[model samples]
Target: MSSLYDLAGPADAGAPGPSDPSDPSDPSGARDVVAFARVAAAAGLGARWPGQVALLGPGAAGAAAGSLLGGAVEPASLDLSAVLDRSAAGGLVDVEFDDAAAVRAGLACGGRASILVQPIGALPPEVLSALAHRRPTAVLTRLDDPALPTRAPAPPGDPAYGDPDSPDSLARSLLERGEPADAVAETASGRMLVSVYVPAPHLVVVGSGALATALGAQLALLGWSSAEVTGLDDALAAVDALGPGDGVLMVDHSADVDGPVLARALRGGVGYVAALGSRRTQAARRERLRAIGVDEASIERLRGPAGLDIGSRTPAEIAVAIVAEMLSVRASTSGAALRDTTGHLNAGRP
Candidate 1:
């Protein structure tokens, strides 16, 4: 009854060194793939490996372009200009037949090294979902055969469209739709590569309203997880549809529609809660909550006027401003443009 995660020891199991046994540095047990890049760059291996996948192991980080290349070629001769071929982000591993190329990757590009491709074997659905939420996953490719089904976390949501004989495999689960899972290892030996979509950061917008719709559209372009809802029912549905590292963004422009929704969403441990309204509108709503015994401390987290004050006049402009603010929050920026910025207090003298 154990998941593939439990069996394969997570994606970075084959990575270097002993992990911190006292306390896990990351909330997700899987390594932080982005951090792996910096580590590889620092290890003097980034420039030495031919084509290798550096596995950073659990509670650590993902691999770097250098580590992946190390797996493909000799680790003692990593160089900068070795014709590096990289893949898109998320924990992706590439298995190549060529043992004489420099395989490097940047943050967000996940192509595992060339060893474990074909025999990745079967994984549980929920485990795949859990794996998709910031978990590092290793994928194997058979450089010999290509009719193998490569397994990855199911695409974040249901099929965008369901049609039989549509030839579109979006509806087919990642491990089931294509080449049979049984052939994964064999096909790779024939020159096919399999990549796993390690769970990346995503945001889930629970609530179907103008705000929800707008947020969904905007966040999609930003590569964040988002969904919409008209009522609490829809909100629940959206939450049910999302994976981890994902949260419910309830944009309640209408108090009548948002009051209970906001309360419930907050109680559900939503990471970001911002209601679309003015200070007074939010205050009035807060008082309404007080009347119902919701404490001031619990209600204070609400970000009213939800976005940064950018003098936005139109709904579309306002939507852009809100998304920008959210991105700023995510990136830990001051929401100030570089063109208008003064000295950065955090910048140290060279």
Candidate 2:
């Protein structure tokens, strides 16, 4: 039998294997996604769609609910049982959906969707692991355009090819931008699809107060994860739990709690650190941090009274405001109203 990647030479042909995600040097975790997409494209699988194979899974409404195969033998027509069969042999297939047929199936509420079919093992283990852990990642896919070369001469944003100053590395740029989600862009090479995976921010609330509880519940509603640290001694471990994009909410307000916790957070490189307090309180905290040897720059990073100026009164309202501020910081936005911002709304986006 011919291999799925036969058209692309071999899976590990002359091309370089994907970089190790465990390597601390490659923190983006996009290398595997790029490698797999490249393989699929070279193999001419889903040539039009590049890296994906769609399956007509649930939420598909229409008249032809049972005719999922659409009387076709293409990979997309494979049913659940067939998919299981293919997986047993390490096969990947694409399932296409016909909206009209679905509408005819007498299903009024379900919508049409194509599922990307593949064995769990076919995917890069690193990408899967990162997703399981809610780490921030981006998947950059280059389309097969007859007009363009088979491979891009250089990674986007690289200094190669006479433009050392160009910061066009698509993967890096995407990582620098907003929440991980699907985005499209036209590049010098061709059109590209970027599937960004921004794991929900894990909020570390360093307090057992009502505000901390409310914040945890609110984060849950947003599908974000939160770790609550009630005691001062536990603050360090909680602060250490934060990854690159995670945040620290110091609502505990006790110098005993905030002092060591804030110092550790600043030193450890948490994305956001905010304490609940007034201006005078923040000043005092700053002084305390300095005495503990926390530098001025790190002290400056703290957002005391952490929240937007929406005039929050209750604990719930405060939670909303603080979360909003953290989100704004994460997105690198000023938290201003969208109506007030000018220029292409998605200028920096893919």
Candidate 3:
């Protein structure tokens, strides 16, 4: 990253953003992450899409990521127990992870030793969203601690290995390979704590208008991506244009038009479907949707008010709440910024 220009030549150059000067919500620092990653990938490193996972544990996180590389390429562990030095492809780097170090290095936690896994390519959509918005995410990693009785924890209904509390071996391996698994689990006995600083959730906001614009700016800070989709037809078309793991947020809901768009979106297997409207308007729309067989479950995920219940007044505030809700539901957790605490965590990786 010292000479990022040597990487991809600016990706079209808009000034390497360090988003704002002091705002923790700025996306600039996040850009540093992307630049370094892209450079590494361009250099032919073993990093790739969805970004990378920075494991927090002993040699665990490193071993986990290296294992994820697949094929027969085993990760070389440079335990701090040895002197740090430069070598060929199989060289070693001396480093140590701790609570204070986590904050300083932006790894995960202070007390835990971690592996900072960074994808060598474009980060996963979720990580990108988190970066753009400056939100915290939960990550799970394993422990060599003797406190746990040595049994793999039950799969917490989440494919992310297990809960972000304790990650299973499979989760660590996948994360190392650059696939973004939602949760990670260790087991019933392992030390459990979620790594935070996950990128914000992204929402492709289709349709242009006051709402779209307002939402875009607001979501940008809430750790959500708010892209504008102009019309119902355009929105529907965009849905088809999306790849797997993409999410959409639609505004300007005209029953006759948006309803069909919603149907197409649902059928397309989009993750989150939301529209903006007044209470009465949303209720009536729901009734009509059921009449057309849109189903109660999908309808339930639909946020009529489209935001957390913070009683936001301005369009900007409302937009914040909406994007916040999108992130909450996307992670399947209640709304609470992850930066202030150290309970659950996930690293945004390739």
Candidate 4:
């Protein structure tokens, strides 16, 4: 393992870090990444949490941050790919791009790019933790003498990264968008990259059968946290947890078991609400909801026979289809085939 200096300022030793940076057990920063990810995931980091990547240093050159936006560990492929095809192998570069294609794709607001690309695993534990739990986190990397470090240090106090209480905190300002606040600001240390990671929307799965079980498992694989509601009580309780970035799914076989929960979830203004069943079953359920005074608008919000037209057969496959549709709703995509779709693959990321 390569040894290097600290990239971020020194933080207090008592902060909520996964591993002690000064520990002798793992000096290579390997254990901290694993430990931080483990703790953050356990704390309910939403599925859409992007990777923790930081681009630090004075403006210089040819690197794109597309990977950072998509939560990938590596840097993005720059438009100047022909110039420095292997420059990023070391993860730090100072080349300039010919066009702002990468910026248009969703990155820091500029065409001129020169920065040290910090690996996602090397992000500070505080930033990583905030990202894991969907807390709004602003990564302020000092760029005076930018250097990639083998060990990423937690930033010392000043601008609170994830502190919700501070009015001037970037966390408060970054709440307006789900995607990163791609911009650069002049800081005391020099130019800094201010990338914000907002929490992904929550998915609440209602029911207690094999479908629900498969749904929960599938969501976990996506790094998303979901609440499983098996009864009216659980469903009502889950409504309190619903926010603008949350949705609900009904998978129970009985309307008696799924209707009340679905009604409450829809009324709560969740982003997506879907129920599994056949088309005929959906129509019957719609009428039943109408009889209960669910109204046309609310009834319109419900997506019965949930999931895309993937012809899925098993519970696991159905779960995939449903999640796919939910993802499409979140991305504002038509849920159409990618081949049929035009434009950048990562457009409209939130």
Candidate number achieving the greatest TM-score relative to the actual structure: 2
Tens-digit per-residue lDDT, 1-350, candidate 2: 11111211211112312433234234223222211211221211221322232222221121111122222223323443354343332223343335454345433322333332333233344444444333555553443342221222244454643453222355455556645434455667666545555544678887777887889888888757677777776777566545557888887777788888989989888888998888999899999999999988888889987999998999999999998898787767787777988887745332
- CA lDDT, every model vs. true structure: 0.41, 0.54, 0.44, 0.52
TM-score of each: 0.44, 0.59, 0.45, 0.50
RMSD (Cα, Å) for all candidates, in order, is: 17.7, 11.0, 13.8, 13.6
Say which prediction, candidate 1 or candidate 3, comes out ahead on lDDT: 3
Tens digits of lDDT, candidate 3, 14-65 = 1233433123333334333321211011112223223233221222232222
Tens digits of per-residue lDDT, candidate 4, 1-350, equal: 01111121111111223433334243233223211110011111122223344332222343332232233223323322322234332333443323364454443332333434443444556654443323455554444433523222224464444454432254345545565443444645554444455444567777666777787788878756576666667666665445445678877767676767777767767778998778998998888788777889999989888999999989899989988888888777798887887899867555
Question: What digit string (tens of lDDT, one per residue) describes model 1 on residues 2-90?
Answer: 12222223221222112221222322343332222211121222333211333232222213223343233332233211112231122
lDDT: worst 10-residue window of model 1: 34-43
Give candidate 1 regions above 4 Å deviation.
1-115, 118-214, 240-247, 251-256, 291-297, 339-350
Instruction: For each of the candidates, give the backbone clash count.
Output: 56, 24, 43, 11
lDDT for position 292 in model 3: 83
